[model samples]
Structure formats: C-alpha cells, structure tokens
Target: MENANDGKYVHINGNDIYYESYLHQQSAKETIILMHGFLSSSFSFRRLIPFLQKEYNVISIDLPPFGKSGKSRRYRYSFENLANTVIQLVESLHLTKITLLGHSMGGQIALNTANIRPDLVQGVILLCSSGYMKKSKPLLILASCLPQFHRFVKRRLERSGLENNLRFVVYNQSIIDKEMEEGYLAPFLKDDIFFALTKLIRDREGDLSKDILNELRVPCLLIWGEQDQVVPLEIGKQLHKDLKKSKLIVLKETGHLIPEERPEEVFHYIKEFITDKG
Candidate 1:
C-alpha cells in the first residue's frame, strides 16, 4: 500500500517544489497531475488520491507560497511563472501526455500549462476554476498593488477569517473539524507566508480569456459544485459554452470543495472521462 502522505522535493525555477506521487503497479502508462488552489496544498486531494491511484498513477504537487514548497521574497508570483515552473517539473520527471487536474486557481494554472505545451498535456480537468469567473475586486487588487499594504493584509487574515472562509466554501459545515483546519493552516505557520500570497495576488496577470480557451487543443472537463459560492456554477457553464472541446459536470449539495465534499463522485467522473478512450 502506498502511503499518500509521504512526499519528496525537487528544485525547480530556483525553488524547491514539494510533490507526492502514488505510483500504482497496474497503471503506469497514464499520469494525472493534481494541482491545488489558493490557500490550499496537495493535501486537499487526500480523499481522491487513493481512489484515483487504484487504476492510474497520481502525482499531487504543492505550488510554492501555498504549501510545504519553498518560498522567496524575490521570486515572481504570476500565473505565467507558476506555469513555467510546472513545465520544468514535468520535464524534470520526464512525464508526458498527462491529464492535468486542477482545482480553483490551480485550474487556471493547468489551462495555462496546457496552452503552453499541448504536446505534454493530454487533457484537462478543472474543479471550480477561477480564471473564467468575474474579475477580482478592484479594491483588493489595489491593496495588493501597494507593497506597504502587504503587511496590513497579512494581519487581517486572522484565525476568524480563516474559519469564516472555510464555512463559506464548504457547504457541509460538519466536516470543518480541527484536523481539517490544522491541515489547511499548516502552511501559514511559515514566516511571511501572507507576504508571499499577497505577491501572488498582485503579480498575477489577467484572467484566462476566451481567446485562450478557444485555442486549447486538448480535451477539458469542467466540474463544479452546484452551490459553489466562491467561483459559482455560472462560470463553469460559461467555460463549457466557450471551450469547444470541453464538457461540464455539476454536483449537487456541494460547494467549492467538491473534491473534499464529494470525492467519490469526482473520482467516477474522472475515471469515466479518462477511460472513455475518446
């Protein structure tokens, strides 16, 4: 039995990237790369890993500034830079023709990566993706732009705010236990994490445009929680409408954390999509 918790680190783009690989014996040809969203780590996919690893090799990555991965004050935090680092990681591992699975912000990074190297990516799976949604709040953007405000923003993300965010994103409040909070809050224990996150928000380029989606050559699957308040279901619908080769699936009684809220359904959807041989 593979221990999904064990992880390794690799140097990519001058930073150490942490990732966990579940290499099942039966399925070695196909690979699935899991990318988590903002304020999240690879740990978000804990429930889905075992289910997916049953028939396919799974690799979950910790994007820097958010997980156990190394962070630096000087590194660029734009989505383009993040995509480049992911590409470098893929090349370093000699992984090819992968199914790129991303959640929330990770979805944007996945799309960006696929757009850059269609040759390496075979398909894309987006869970409550963000790039196609409404533009970010101008006030927040302005706040992020001012370097002096970074500390203020950092101070504002108190435990209460974190708890409130958890409640807002996960429809089933019962699952918001101590363990879950601790897991999600672990990365913040590192010094100056808020500064890193602020940099990420401020440096990110504009959202992924329809023009970019139209140019995507690989297959895409957009999965959403019908009750998602963060990104909303309409965004997923719009993405499906815009992406010529994409399909959408919305789960009931769920929120933004579909993978955590309904892992089995997500597993089935992904399995059917990947196994259809389309």
Candidate 2:
C-alpha cells in the first residue's frame, strides 16, 4: 500500500507536470501544496501525505525534469519560472490560499512563489531551505561553465552513485532501502534529464534575500534537522533570525531528508502550524 497514490498531470509551459492529490470530504477552504527538493520528486512525501490528507486537502507535485513530469529542452528551469508554473497549477486547479510546503530547493521555489503571489499563498513552510546557501553558487557556476566537469559530475549519478547520494541525504542510513533508492533514481535515468538539469543549474539566479524575506507578510515555519549535512543547521538558524514572524523547530538526530527520516515529527509540526489560530 505504500505506493498506492495515483498521480495526475497538468499541462503547463508545453510540459505535462505530474502531481498527486489527496482530497478530503470537508470543503477545500485550505490546502497544502507540497514541493520536493532538488533532484527529488513528490514520492519523497509518500509516507507523510496520508497524515496530512486526514484533516485537509493535500497535493504533492513532481517538478518537471525531476519526476514523472515531462521535460522539454526549451523550457527555462529558473526558480522564478518554476514558481510561476506552480502558481498556474494552483489557479488551474482552483486552489486558494494554500500553505506552500517546500523542502530544500523546493523551499526556495516556495519562497519565490510567496514573494511573487502573496495573494495565493496563505502561509509558507520551509524544510531546510537552500536560499541561504551562499557557498553553492561559485561551485555551481564553475560546473555549469565546464562541460567536462559537468560530465564528470553526471557520471557520479549512475546507479551505485545514485544510491550513495540518496544515503548521503539522511542521517539514518537504514532508510536508504530499495524503494527509496529507486524512487529518487528513476527520474535521473530519463534521456533528457541531464540536459534539463544543465539548464536548471545554468539558469540559477537570485536568492531569498533579507529584503524578500522581510517582505513575506504571511506566516512562515522553519523546520530543520539538527544534523543536516547538505544545507547545514547554521543556515536554518540564520533564516529563523532573519524572518520576523517565523517559528523555528530543529529536530534532533534528523537530517536533510526529514520527511523520509522522521515523517511523524514532520506531520506533527505541520499540523499544528496549519491549525494555529494566531
């Protein structure tokens, strides 16, 4: 029953984006839009979505080039454009005032979406966001500029390498089971994946600066794994300090893959966040 969720597709920007929706009997006054991180898909939330759908409607998206979603060589992969596509998806599906839940790179896209369309987002939840990663740019730019270097990087994403990379994201290594490995690696095996990724990295620009963070008038929640190796705990601490009306919760013994590593804890925090009347 783990992979029972059947996903549907929406056409946008000449791409067929994939998403899974969990509907509740209650009216859809509020909903949660889940966005996965870099090199990840909505399958990351498979264990967590059931808990969320119990009380409110929940939808998880597979950002193009990263899930069952279709990819195009011509589609721009910048965060802004991706965020706009999410907005279009929301509008097309008639969702209103959603709480944008984004993990890592998806968090950055959520922040960008909230900034661009504050009217559509009721709140924002960040799971070890990447906007504060200042050291990543130079390395990304270097790799993007060097074709050979990029190829070398791509080589590391082969089957075994992909499994290793998946294990690297979580503090608990036991969760790197066959299902998890396959779920994360399947997207990369597609023919156009590398090209789409190249475009994504080459087009990377801007960050959720203090000005944009300050301008975010909606409620924001910051969740971090105490031992997150990828984005680090310091970034989360700094992000919490910068946001005026945000609550910060750091989970002990957790890693960047909080949803997979500790879904119960994640669900608890998110449920409280959405229900809070303050």
All models: lDDT?
0.85, 0.83
| Cα error, candidate 2, residue 75 (Å) | 0.8
Compared with the true structure, model 2 gives a TM-score of: 0.91
lDDT of 1: 0.85
Residue 211, model 1: lDDT of 90
Q: Once superposed on the true structure, which residue ranges of model 2 sit more than 4 Å away at CA?
A: 1-6, 134-153
Clashing pairs in 2: none
The digit string of per-residue lDDT tens for model 1 on 53-114 reads: 88788889998887988777677887878989999998998888999999999999999899
Q: Candidates' TM-scores?
A: 0.93, 0.91
Candidate 2, residue 243: the lDDT equals: 79
